[model samples]
Target: MNKKSLSQQIYEARWCYLFVLPCSILTGMFVLYPIGMSWYFSLLDWSGFTKDAKFIGLQNYAEAINDPFFWNAFSRSFIFMFGTVPVKIILGFVIAVFLNNQVLKLSPFFRTIIFMPVVTAIAIIGIVMTFIFSPFNGPANKFLMATNLTSGPIDFLGNPDTVLPTVMGVYVWKWLGITMMYWLAALQTVPQDVYDAAKIDGAQGYRLWIHIILPIVLPFAIVIILVEAVSALNVFPLIETMTAGGPFFSSEVMEVYIFRTAFVTDAGTMPRLGYACAAGVFWGVAVLFITALQGFWMRRTRRI
Candidate 1:
């Protein structure tokens, strides 16, 4: 049979194209349009409020490069990603292993309990966590004091030294359930027969896990870690609600930095929309590079 012409193929799949039209339109409007606009705005000198925007070429980007606060925010984002991703992966895998045990009772209930936070609104969790970790009369400090863990209340969200780590901890706790679910799914891919055969051969417990189960689930673990690493960079809402990048901008990630530059202007200074867009474009490229790296690694792992 002859291959169909492009026009003929289009005619045959007209209904499929029709079905995809709405999503394509929405994506163009929301995703593509904004991306294009961001790049265009990055080359301009616009305050976002004024109708007139002067084209300044790459000055905004150059300014961003020299800006110390921009570098600080960028470093903080990576720190958060590095801090949370490993803890989430290891802890999530451990919890998933425990829950995946066939002899364990009420595993489903425990899974639901753990996963509840994943579905909870970040804003709500942030608010509740802020209150819980409040420096004065907060439940956490109260407990610590009660147990004599510390003689004085610790400002978990207030101190610059502690804020980022405290935020990282909350982020891991909030998203741990999803990572656990990923591990649980990976665990399910191991056949019962494989486990039984391993048992028959006297391979059990840590030996069975390290030798057999780990090899089987290694790919999934890698993918999960990469995905979570990307996710760990996006904690704007939680940080905003809990600390608002407070105590002298200690917790300002890229997202918060962009928002502050684009919208939050101090007295006598206009909102630097163009500069913010430049920063955003830079950060977006970095994230895109990371995502591409993830794809490359995943492909290599699949080949192996």
Candidate 2:
């Protein structure tokens, strides 16, 4: 290419990079920077309490595999992911469908009310949920008592049997709006002619959902499912705010456990920074794998 043409191209490229420089720098400092440091730290044995860091290779990973607490937390992540994603997707779709009906009035008001929690403080919701789950003097138990549904108080958050479910419920409440909004956007894009054709073909209700609406919204549904899967696997704030994975670690997800390992422990002037780094690395890799699989499935579905 001529020098003038090449110079013009270089100038354009330089300006493009300059425009994106701020975003790239922020991402590097906040995201890529930590990831790089974590990878380095994962190869060392550092009691986060001091500067006495010793390089220990893959020992932390070895210990992580054998650590019962680590495995328990890891397993809990999957269970919570499985419980939350399907419920969120299905309920969000149903709610979107219900609200989409022409007969529904004041739809914007209802949508705003539903989405309020999405903007609420995580700590506030956690505290409110904790109160609601309180066995004594909680509003929920008061309702149950007044209705005679149960004479006894239900310690929803305290009981190991119910902690996971309680957290799951909190997750649904927090995320349902976002998912519903997504579904609503997708539904609005559905061609009206398709529904008209379906009606003429004697397709209605469940048949229409199964044969028409679903097929058209399949791409939207796939995106939500994959997004939910990855997010649920990394669930933290609600758990952090509500249970703190407490009541005997019954509700502990991988995230809270990792943070606890990093900052909450002291082994006679020793901290476990390296182990925490390893755990962080493990979680990141797990998320990446799940995302890759999701992309593959989405591609296959679109092809079909």
Candidate 3:
């Protein structure tokens, strides 16, 4: 038989290419276009609304590098990432284990209940949480007062010392359900026969999880870690709804700073669209670097 020519091969796969064309076009339009625009805007000096965008080369980037507030917000982003990731992952894993148990009944109901928060509107959660943690007439404060743990409302979202951690706690709670679903799906992929063999070899209780379940679940855990890292680092809505970066910019993260610089400002000043874009570009590069590092680490783990 004669080998097919390149043209012949292309003709045979034309339908497959056609099927992918729409998705490719949409991705280019929405995702790729914005990224390119952001890079171009980063080199300019203009408010987003203005038609006259002055090209400023690397000045915006230089200013961002020296901006103390940018670094401060970046540090808070790291704190939010670290604080939320481990707690959610561990709690999610534990819940997944419990739900996976044969002895557990009505697990589907429980799963739906737990996962409701994951599907619920984040804006609603942030608003409700703000009220729950409100200094005046909030249930949380009332409970603390009733329990004699405090003299009055603690102002969880007010004080700089407590605001960041409180937000972290809320983030973990909101995301735990989705994290558990990841673990649960990973756990389901493990063969029951493997567990049976481990049991027959005298593996039970913590040993079963340590040796068998954990190894199988590790890849999924890596995915969860990366997802949570990105999500936590880019946190915006909750901070906006609950604290708006604070009483003193205590709970501010990179995203909050970007929004403020881009849109929010004093009465007479123009929004710093270019500066905000510069900050965004810098942090976007940093996030990409961190994610690439994480992927390399996961790949190495798979080899080991």
Which candidate number has the best TM-score?
1
Clashing pairs in 2: none
Better of 1 and 2 by TM-score: 1
Across 237-295, the per-residue lDDT of candidate 3 in tens digits comes to 88888888987999889999999999999799999999999999999999999999999
TM-score of each: 0.98, 0.94, 0.95
Instruction: Select the stronger candidate by lDDT from 1 and 3.
Output: 1
RMSD in angstroms between candidate 1 and the native structure over all alpha carbons? 1.0
lDDT of 1 by residue, 17-65 (tens): 9999999999999999999999999999999998999999999999999
Rank ordering of all candidates by lDDT, starting from the highest: 1, 3, 2
Which is the winner by lDDT between candidate 2 and candidate 3?
3
* Model 3 pairs whose backbones collide: none
lDDT tens readout by residue for model 2, 1-304: 5466877788879978898999999999999999999999998898776888899899999999999888889989999999988999989888888888778887778889899998998778998998987898899899999999999998999998999998998888988899999999999989999999999999987999899988889898898898888878867878988998888889989998888888776456555888999998988898899899889999998888
Segments in model 2 whose C-alpha atoms lie over 4 Å from true places: 1-8, 266-269
Give the number of the best model, judged by lDDT: 1
Question: For each candidate, what is the lDDT?
Answer: 0.94, 0.88, 0.90
